[model samples]
Target chain A: MIEVEGVERRYDGVAVLSEVTLSLPKGGLTAIIGPNGAGKSTLLSVMGRLQKPDAGRVTLEGMHLAQAPGRAVAKKLAMLRQDNHTAARLTVRDLVAFGRYPHCRGNPGPEDQAQIDRALAILGLEPLADRFLDQLSGGQRQRAHIAMVLAQDTGCILLDEPLNNLDISHAVRIITLVREAAQALGKTVVVVLHDINMAAAHCDRIVVMKGGRILRHGTPAELMQADFLSAVYETPISVHELAGRLVAVY
Target chain B: MSPEIRARQITHRMALLALLALLAAAAFLLLNARGSWDFLLPFRGRKLAALAVVAVAIALSTVVFQTVTQNRILTPAIMGFDALYVLIQTGLVFGLGAGRVSALDARLVFGLELGAMVVFALLLFRWMFGPAARNLHLLMLVGIVLGTLFRSIAGFLQRIIDPDSFTVLQDRLFASFNAVDPGLLTLSALIVAGLALILWRLVPELDVLALGREAAVGLGVPQERLVLGLLVIVTLLVALSTALVGPVTFLGLLVANLAYLLLPTGRHAVLLPAAALIALITLIGGQALLERVLHYDTALAVVVEFAGGLVFILLVIRGVAR
Candidate 1:
């Protein structure tokens, strides 16, 4: 479980995240949905320990993220930010193998290699394992990044804007992989998503944010009402049940 | 390429570089030699050692710096190291005049330059990366600004100083291998060896750092501490090399890029040595060619800067086109 209490982050005297508190459940797919500048990514960044909060504390599984050893925290939590880039040219296999650095410290044993192979197999990246990241398409590179995250073998995974720039087919494929990781592997997965229908159909819970504050947090069934979403977005949005699933339209 | 094939190919390339470096060293020592064996061996050997030290220092520093900054077109020199060296030499001439500056002990002058540079680099970087970890782009901007400021000040000093003193300063600043201070060469070699040892231990972390700050931090590599340590190492190595020979601006840019292009992988273990060997070959072989074959009177730094500057332009254009 991740506990965030009174977390506030400011930039140049302006608060990007204001007195926000949230508790992320241990094992499920949780999607943070908000419009641009709504602090969705910032909240996720704080929870993942990518950015420190100015006012409060965050703990992952009873261990303070700010005080714990980086290696220990890494073994428990894995965070992947959007638009990953590297100066070094790395192959898919090489990139995934780096996920084991915290454990193996560059000398991967047989077990570490097995984890790498499993990640590649899970993401269907074995075919492209030898290809460099720059040689791959946008979707393929995103998959490669996810594969690396999976190779980390952390209990909790946080991804920021994983679906950005991906096509519908690719996006669905990635969401399915994320869902499967949560379900089959029992990992706590938090994803920041732009597509509401995809989140409604796939995620177990949804957290809505507006103006850097949490507007609502509940199961998709409880939070997918038209009035609440319309108010959260400050625009008219309609929700309809389509074949047993709630779909939102604007 | 498959891992096995790629590993073999890399090994083969490394072997070729080593062989070429050896050939260059031999040719540098043996070409057009007619003095007594005793005098020839020690004199040529000292020069060879000095060149090799500078080559290693510059190449290693450049590659490590580029990896930290995640930039292909940048070198440590862009942080105004070379400009600072010029400023130091010009300042000495301006303040003390040419004759007195020349009469001062060469080792004392070298010590002064090296100390001032290292101190300046630390202060500037501390201010940038101190209270909070400032972003690298801001750090780069400050470095460029300070570099331009140093250049302008040096230019002002040069304009006012007498022509004879100005000529003396120019000779001191131009990067001539023919005038390496022998007393300081041994000291530089020792310092470089120590710095290389520290860098070698951080190779694995550096490989992770190439993934950029977020990924590095996520993977349990303490990004702030590691980057700060690497920057200090870079400052020391750049200071050592620049004090030994005046600034050889483009050699690091040329050799590091060549290492990346030649080697098919990104592992720093392989890349660092490849860059060093290439630098060694460039300096030694280019010196031999100019001295023996063409009978050229120009410093080897001139030829290197010409080639390196072209490579820099090509790299920039290619990046933009891409």
Candidate 2:
């Protein structure tokens, strides 16, 4: 379980997140839904230990996030940000192999190779593994990066806007993959998403944020109401049930 | 490519580097052996040793600096290291008379230059801007400002010094491989070797570091401390080489980029040696051509700078600045 207590983050006297407390239970998909400037990415970064909170504590399975050794924490949690610009001429396989660095420290053994192959297979990247990142299309590159994080084999995965730059087909595939990983592997997945309908359809729990604070948190059925989303987003949203799944139309 | 195929390619490149380094060393030794066996051997041997030391210092420093900055076009000299050395020389000549400055201990001068360069680098790194400002443009901008300041100060001091003393300082400022000081060379070799050992121990970390700061940190590398250590190493290497042979700014840029083009892998193990070999070939070959073809009448730095400058322009035009 990941627990955040009174987490506060401010930048140059402007509060990005204020007194945000939340708990993410293990073995499920939790979608953090919010409008722009809602501190979704900031909260994800704080929970992943990428950024420190000004006034709060984060604990991951009984260990303080800040105090734990970086390698130790990396072994248990993996994060993929929105933008990954690199200067090195690395192929898809090369980038994914780096995911095992926390375990093998660049000297990958047979076991590491096996895990890498499994990740490539899962992401449908075996054929494109030899292609350089710059040569791939945006959706392919996004899937490649996701494969890298999945190769890390961490129990808790945090992804900030994983659906960006992906086409509809790739986006649906990725959402299904994340859901499958959470259900089959018993992993806790936290993702920040802009598409409210996708979040409602795939996420077990949705947390709504506005103006740097969590305004509401509940199951999809409760949070997907038209009135709740319209108030949260400041736009008219119609909720409809299509084949037992909630769809939000704005 | 398959892993086996890539490994084979790396091994092949390593073999080629070893062969080139050996050939360069052999040619250097043969060219320096001209007079009586006893007298000429030791005398020219010292000069050869000095050349080898400078080559290694410049090559290693350039490769490491590029890695840390994640830039192919940047070198230690870009940070005004050579300008600082020239400024120090001018200050010495301007403060004391020529006789006193000449009489000062060579080792003492080397130590002072090394210390000043390291301190300057630490200060610059400590004041680094935010992540968005960490691009090559910012580095180049700050470097140009500092370099202009150093050059202007040195020029102003040079104008005030006596003509004879100014001549002495001027001779010291231009890069020439033929007139190396043996004492300074020995000290520099020791410093270079020590730093080389430290870098070898940190090779694994450096491989990760080449991926840039955020990715390195995400992979569990202590980014701040490692970058600081690398800056210090780069400072020592740059200071030692600049003190020995003035400054050859574009030489590092040429060799490092050439290594990148020739070597297919991103692994530092291959990239470092490939760069070192290119430097060795350029220095030894250029020195031979100057001695034999040009009758040892001109500075080797001029030819190297000419070739390196061309390569620099070509690389920029080719849009490989990344």
Model 2 agreement with the true structure over A1-250: per-residue lDDT tens digits: 9999999999877999999999988889999999999999999988988788999989989889888887788899888887777777778998898888888888899999999999999889999998888889888888888988988899999999999999888899899999999999899999999999899989899999988899988899999899988998899999998989889888
Per-residue CA lDDT of candidate 2, range B83-130, in tens?
A: 898898889888987889889987787678778877887777666644
Model 1 reproduced share of reference interface contacts: 0.75
Give candidate 1 regions above 4 Å deviation.
A167-169, B131-133, B307-322
lDDT of each: 0.89, 0.83
The native-contact fractions of the candidates, in order shown, are 0.75, 0.42
Candidate 2 DockQ vs. native: 0.60
Question: Where does candidate 2 chain A have its weakest 10-residue lDDT segment?
Answer: A81-90
Error of 1 at A128 (Å): 0.8
Candidate closest to the true structure, highest DockQ: 1
lDDT digits (tens) for residues B212-319 of candidate 1: 888888888888888989989999999999988889878888999888877878899999999999999888887777777767777787767765567667866876
